[model samples]
Target: MANTAVRVRLTRGASEGDVAALKAWLERERKLEALRSSGELEIQERAGTQDGQGQARPMGAGLDIMLVLIGAAAPKLFDEVYEQVKSGVRAWRENRRDVENGEPPEVEVAPDGDGR
Candidate 1:
């Protein structure tokens, strides 16, 4: 693996609340929690600026659940994390009544670039 960090993000046709719920759901995974506790994974929220106050706020369209791989063990741990995340997304999607209304949920794994 490259020396740089790898970022994995999950996105779905969601409302802001849905994004938050998905994040919470993923956090409940035992393996993910353990990896986080060990500093091998990092979770981040993607938000947009509020119109007037310039404050960061979650947006539904592009809101994503991002995992950053930062530790030396990340290569080995990557599969475990990916599987857990996939399971979480699957569970989340199964509970949505409008699962067929828009694009399906997806996970993207890419090089950690400029934090975007």
Candidate 2:
């Protein structure tokens, strides 16, 4: 079976702790069991250097994650994954005063299209 993947990248708006929390939640949260058991969903973390941050931001890679959906997934599945991730991050940022501001860090999620 072929596998499609989506990369979820976060900016400095998310702290190291936040990244760890998100990874843990997505991996172990009971709420996500349905998605986990579907055989259509899989998650992974990748490590790499953060390039092009310029002078304003730091230059280092954060703990970014990827979501892999097996087989030919429907468009709605993408939305479902996006929402799940956003919800997870939102929950993590809720109580934190520093990141609870009007504008939180940016989360960019996009499909790589290369079914491995």
Say which candidate scores most in TM-score: 1
Model 2 residue 97 CA deviation (Å) reads 4.2
Instruction: Candidate 2: give the clashing pairs.
Output: none
Which portions of model 1 show Cα errors greater than 4 Å? 1-13, 47-60, 98-116
- Clash number by candidate, in order: 0, 0
> How many pairs of residues collide in model 1?
0
Model 2, 16-103: lDDT tens digits are: 6656666776666454556778777777777534523423346534656777666566345766666677677666556444545554
> Following a full C-alpha superposition, what root-mean-square deviation does model 1 have from the true structure?
6.5
Superposed by TM-score, candidate 1 places the C-alpha of residue 51 at a distance from the truth, in angstroms, of: 22
- Among all windows of ten consecutive residues in candidate 2, which has the lowest summed lDDT? 48-57
lDDT of each: 0.60, 0.61
lDDT of 1 by residue, 1-116 (tens): 33233343444444666667777877777887887888777777764333223355344445545676675676666666666777767776676536556554564544443433
